[model samples]
Target: MEKIAITTDYITLGQFIKFIDVIPSGGMVKYILQEYTIYVNDVEESRRGKKLYPGDKILIKSIGEYRITKQ
Candidate 1:
């Protein structure tokens, strides 16, 4: 799995998606969330505002798996 390091306690799903370059802008987060099937810690997630903390695992079917880490 790819590792994504974050400096903060948590990052919103939308921000993470943008940070990974999955979408062009934050405004597209809603659209991308609807188009892609994303899982967080094994649970299917759809909320763009979902807070992801260090050690969280994310799986995006069309993309790849990722693990959050402290930066």
Candidate 2:
């Protein structure tokens, strides 16, 4: 598991994915989101614009776990 600090109240899933280096670019994030399953707070999430807040846990298939924190 890894911890990520967010400077804002929330971050979009696509932004978070890129922030964590899960995907190389914005164009690829949509494709990756559609191809794989990403869990937000233990629920399957497919929306690229899904909002993630502090303490949210994201499970990206084959990528690893990421926990969010407020900075």
Candidate 2 clash figure, as a count: 0
Alpha-carbon RMSD to native, per candidate: 0.5, 0.7
Off by over 4 Å in 2: none
Local accuracy of candidate 1 as per-residue lDDT tens digits, 1-71: 99999999999999999999988888999998999999999999999989999999999997999999999
Show pairs that collide, candidate 2.
Answer: none
The true-versus-predicted C-alpha distance at residue 44 of model 1, in Å, is 0.2
Q: What is the TM-score of each predicted model, taking all chains together? A: 0.97, 0.95
lDDT of 1: 0.95
Residue 67 in candidate 2 has what lDDT?
98
Model 1: CA > 4 A from native: none
Q: Write down the TM-score for model 2.
A: 0.95
Per-residue lDDT for 47-66 in model 2, tens only?
Answer: 98999999999999988999
How big is the positional error of residue 25 in model 1, measured in Å on the Cα after superposition? 0.7
